[model samples]
Target: MATRISSSFRGLILLSFFAYLCLCAHEAEETTETQHHHQISHTIPVISLIPSNACTSSAKGSERKASLEVIHKYGPCFQSKNYDEKVPNHLEILLQDQARVNSIHSRLSKEYSDNNKSRDSQVATLPATSGLPIGTGNYIVTVGLGTPKNDLKLIFDTGSDLTWTQCEPCARSCYSQVDPIFDPSKSTSYSKISCNSSECSQLISATGKPTTLLLYLRLRIRYKYGDGSFTIGDFSKDRLTITTEDVLDNFLFGCGQDNEGLFKGAAGLLGLGRNQISIVKQAAQKYGQFFSYCLPSTSDSKGHLTFGNGGVSSTVKFTALQTLSQSQSFYGLDLIGLSVGGTQLSIPKSAFSQEPSSIPARLSKVCLAFAGNRNETSIGIIGNTQQRELEVVYDVAGERIGFGKGGCR
Candidate 1:
């Protein structure tokens, strides 16, 4: 009986020992898993927040703004040459502009003659110039491109649709630029648009190229300015960095290989037109299709280009955008009359038609002209003149332009 009781007690002790071992092993396994999970969590990379994207979310579909500094090309701060040297340069630019204007008028006339019957009777007359700055003396904005970001100062052109810059491996030609040429090879995000793409097809059609050629060749874009300046290059997609921190991905732009003309020190051109390919259109999703700018009187004073409602204020005077069948790219304004210091001018309403080839006296120097010296011609320009005096708002949603005076000095 004593041996049986001792054997039973030994069996119970053995059972307890085995159960304790199993429990310890299970605990060890769970601890190892927890440590492994912690290791993985530390190894993973965290995504950094994008300012523009953050703003978009925080606004809850409300208005968001992105501000850009306006660079005055020939302002006193940017003048590198003497006044005498600038005179000849200005005259040369004016001549080129005159030629360009004549070419546009001739082309329009030919088009009218060819398709006048087929076209609508209400076909709007093309403007002499699209109120864009003609010469190198204009405004520019700094933009960063590529993965790591290569900064390029580009001209802000309201009349143009394609934004472009000189690129590397210039097998064809590239002019001397103030900044280093952008190298696509260095950018991981840079990509060439396939010929099969719709964008490429549209580009080919716009360039008057046969659609059949697209199947055999890559897409290329060519832009010719009124000043006789031209750029032809590949259509590509890349990242555009604005304000040094705000990044916009999959941005379409031209990579110029064969570039010529009066770019001055600018690396490229930023198209702000009402085209599908324009910068404003591309960023409309985030910016609400609204933009405004305040041009400073002096180059030393900093001006700004604001996306969304940054420049809007209570004092702005709104005007309806004129409907024109000729082109939707140009921002057309109806000029019923002109007032000078609260005095209305006696100029005929017809004189303000067709972008006014020449502004009458009293209205002199008030309208902005593409070419010619400001003194030789009274051609007024609202680009730098009015922009310098007021805050100009391009409200695409409202289909109107707003001018707020006393915003800039």
Candidate 2:
């Protein structure tokens, strides 16, 4: 019995020693962790992590990752019961600390994206369209051409072919509102067709008025900003200077003209529609064969226009209607098929008008008219009433139509 008691006492003593050793080991570990935290705090203060502005929702994820990355690379300055909840108090502070290197990287990223998008747009012309009238026929816009006499922009149009702006032969002083008339005297390449020139004759407005030229394209733009309108002062023979991804050359344009109430910047107009030998056509001949324009939508007030190659994106299907004979140029289309999203739509042949009066004199001129808005005497006035109901797109790459407009608001 005495021997057993002694053995039990010995066993108790050993167990106590073991427990004491474990306690010492745990204390040592705690001290080591504390020392590591202190070292990190000295290296990078927590105050350096906050941004000047409050973090936006987008930055939250990035901020979290960045904070963790810093900790991983250099150890953390603070301790948390749970590692997942560890976060810095500020993000801008971190950015400021790394400002010099960070800014350079950010700028390079932006530039790369811009360059990529421009190149893609230029190469996508097979599926895109020029916002300008590249072919022949008729097209119209509510243009406010600035008058050289009064500098008043005027707006009236027919989807025809020709470009001329109001110029200085007016009964009144022509320079009151317009910028100094385009002085062809300035450009080495300026050439004038006589007032009786055939090109000028073709410019006869549907209203039977004579077309006039004031300033032709050079390499300058004269702006009159009082009425949300402006003008390009440079007109040239089949050449235009525009900022683009491609090296554009030899385009033509009407430097400026006075139209009535069409734009918001100046007293001039750019003859961009599919009129004869206008600025847009000249540029296409010299650059890429196509361009595109996306008008402002209610959801997105600003859109884009691309010439040449366009971007690749998922396409909504569409039904192509038979293009009117006049649907050849300026603004024309060959209606072949139509689809919405992925569904095809059928259009009745009766939807087309066969009456000579209902049809435009020109075979390629497609008339956009309302069912009840047809004027017995009017030739090709596309009724504005129906513009809101349909989205029109033209496939000119095919055999039926060469020009197109619509699918924009």
lDDT of each: 0.52, 0.26
Identify the leading candidate in terms of lDDT: 1
- The TM-score values for the models, in the order shown, are 0.66, 0.34
Report clash pairs, candidate 1.
367-380, 367-381, 368-380, 368-381
- Model 1 agreement with the true structure over 1-409: per-residue lDDT tens digits: 0111110000000000000000000001111111100000011111210111111011211232477676455443343332212322536645544443444344334434544343321111222221223344356677899988998878776555567789887867776666788999999999988788877654543333455545644666666544445677778889998765467898888888877754656777787767667787878887777887665444444466677765367777776654333344556553332344444355432343543434455742243433322232111222233245356777877887776754443
Off by over 4 Å in 2: 1-160, 163-181, 194-239, 244-250, 254-267, 271-276, 286-288, 298-300, 316-323, 326-371, 374-409
After superposition, the stretches of candidate 1 with alpha carbons farther than 4 Å from their true spots are 1-65, 76-137, 201-210, 225-228, 340-383
How far residue 274's Cα lies from its native spot in candidate 2, in Å, is: 4.7
Model 1 TM-score is 0.66
